[model samples]
Target: MKAALSSVPEKQQQDSEFLREVLEGLGGKRKTLPCKYLYDEVGSRLFEDICEVGDYYLTRTEASIFANNLRDIASEIGRDALLIEPGAGNCEKVEALLAVLESPRGYYPIDISPEILLDAERRIKANLPEMQVWSEVGDFTQPGVWDRLSMIPSRKRVVFFPGSTIGNFEPEKAEELLEMFAANLGTGDGLLIGTDLVKDSVRLERAYHDSEHVTEKFNKNLLSRINSELGADFDLSLFAHRAFYHQLRKRVEMHLVSLKKHSVSIADTRVDFSEGETIHTENSHKYSVSDFNQLLARGGFRPICHWKDSADSYAIHYAQAI
Candidate 1:
């Protein structure tokens, strides 16, 4: 079987990368890990479930904005633009936009998962056979991953990032990423992004710590992944998920706490855990509308138009590289 191949460099690359990141994070003084690791197939599926939960309104609110404003967005983007979406996930958001854009030169959906990318490509190809579907499997955070957008001649480039995923990045890092977008995209190129706005702490807390415990499973899945990929002894039952909004940081932080003092050996490294100790898993930073606009300006983007739900719970901003 293709999966039985024992000598693939890509397979080795993922394992090596996971091992390196785990060791560094576990050894760090803060005992924190990167949120990006939480997207193994199961984690990804859990996230999809989180979106449907009534408490989690980011997806629903943003979807409403798109539904009401897709035509205006498409008009600004114009026709024959190369639509490039980083972290394309299941490509549902891009699909909505594609429906409105007239005669796009190509549809390039980029994601870290090859399986998801292939599925997205198949669906898009089946639905919109007239447009080119060039799906790629790679990390979009890296510098040159987006260089391909320039290759398709005579088409303006448009970068689409939805799902309030930008909240995952710390502010400074977010600015850096937006600047990278500006650098990669040509003059007059547009960037469409969705972001969660700061709101009631209770509602925000409930969104991450959902009633069905799906979010808990999603957070704990990171350890399961580490155990599977690296030879690690992670007794999943000994850890519990916890999420809370940190008002000072304007972010909701998720952690996996140890129920009892324990130790786990990851490869040759043994990491000790004290009772009640935590491994910080993820942070979703909420932003005020004006604060986010300042961030976009710092990233060399000028916000041209935006749409938000009546409650102002979320935002979809269309900005251009300045």
Candidate 2:
């Protein structure tokens, strides 16, 4: 099984940009790294485990809502539209949607990791032999990342952004990304997005800090990845994964706390850690349907239709380019 994979031709520049970002993040006051880096092979597998864990309800709930509302959502998507999914991890939810979507011209599952992206594309093609799969390896947040969509021949385009991944960004940055999506599509094009709604604090917290320890392993894998890729000496056992909901911020914060005072060196960079000091890894902001709609508007999208599961645990919205 083969799939057309598109990646930036400039490998040297890509590496330079990665090292620069890592330096900027580690040297900052908060000491952080982009969550995107966490999707390396091992990290990706750990995340798949997280979605299935008992406490993590987002994935299962979202899939249920999509399944129930598949027909209605397909109506809004219309026929022969090109389906482009950003952060298309494993292409799981999209496969369910493809089962019902009317002859989509093509399916583009874009992700940052090439190995996982191609593997996912192959699986998707195997499942739906007739469907066209074009997977790309690049950061979808970059300004010109959507330029390749223009090369796909289709009158209508639907950007499928499920997994509530938008919550990973600050509201301001989320709006900026939505605006980028708006600029990429023509009038009447759609953005079919899944967002986790604000809910009980305890439930939200548990979803990230799962009892199975899968999320913990997933969080710590970032350090393991850095050590492997950048020649860093990080004793993974020296740090513990910590995640909790910040009531004031209305988001789940993930941190890798130093078990005790320690220091690590990466390439030519030296970073010192204090006992209990943490490197913030990711933030997932929960939202009310109203808050999300306002956010969509700010990004130049108008929510035309939406659906929520029986428990209202999650929502799938269909918005049009304004």
Candidate 3:
């Protein structure tokens, strides 16, 4: 059952917000779209496919690290702590952690995609029948999402932010985001976060632009999402997916390039494209252990300990709200 908390219907309000952001982003000097929208139902499934691609190793590497050190990690988190996962798609990563946790108090998963979040809620109910789950459907970054979390009872609150989702934000924004996470927690509350380590450009490039073309589909899916959700006529065929590592920026930049000059209509708005012009889609920042630790500190968390994969391509840190 859908219930509205305000005069505006939830779905209609969301559509309005999406259309406004789309127009503002496309109207910018550098045409762009927020990466968060990339995970609309279809994009989320494609991302799952991207993770299975051999070229994209972040997922498997993190899992291996967890498989190796889950007990130690859980020991650090200790017992009776509530696990709150933002962007908790399918909530797969937490199943193992929850299994090992010593009498975990409960789980609160916040996600923008209702389909994935609901499916995860059902899975957790069946697999961990004793564990409590309170799932929220909305953007995890929104303050209201975290605010809603305050109502769930727990002995201690720990934010489980796996998958290097932190790297999606710009450095400044990342610091602010961590601070926001900190704002939602008390001192001694925990945070288990992931970060992608800096690697050779060859490896980073391959990760985003896989040979199997799944990443290509993932990138272009943003355009497809805009076309579908906002009534935009984005010609998916006219835009080519391009991804590469920027040496100086220490990040992978993904964009959609226009094959030819064209105009597209979105709702009642018309957006024009120049030949070869591109819409910057997303950035995945790479960080060294030291750099990310500093970032964690700035975000109001004192760095505790971290675990890394065998290849050192990824690192997951355990920090505390300070």
Top candidate on lDDT is 3
lDDT of 2 by residue, 1-322 (tens): 2333434667657666667878889888889988888887798888999999999999999988877888999999999989988888788878878878888898877777677887787788788888988777778887555777778899799999999999999999999989988988888899999899988889998999999999999999988888877788999999999998888888999999999998899887889989998889999999989999999999999989899999888998899998
Question: For residues 1-322, could you state the per-residue lDDT of candidate 1 as single tens digits?
Answer: 0112224896798789879999999998778888998987788878989999998888888999999988998999998888889888888888878877888888777777777777777788788877687776677898655766666674688889999888999999999999988997888889999999988899999999989998999999999999988989999999999999999999999999999999999998999999999999998999887888999999999989888889989998889988
| C-alpha lDDT of residue 95 in model 2 | 88
TM-score per model over all chains: 0.96, 0.95, 0.97
Error of 1 at 103 (Å): 1.6
Candidate 1: worst-modelled 10 consecutive residues by lDDT: 1-10
When sorted by lDDT, best at the front, the candidate numbers are: 3, 2, 1
Among all windows of 10 consecutive residues in model 2, the one with the lowest summed lDDT is 1-10
- Candidate 3, 99-165: lDDT as tens digits: 8999999998888877888788788889999998887778888888777666777788999999989
lDDT of 1 at 151: 63
| Number of the top-ranking candidate, with TM-score as the measure | 3
How far is 155's C-alpha from truth in model 1 (Å)? 2.4
Give candidate 2 misplaced runs (Cα > 4 Å): 1-11
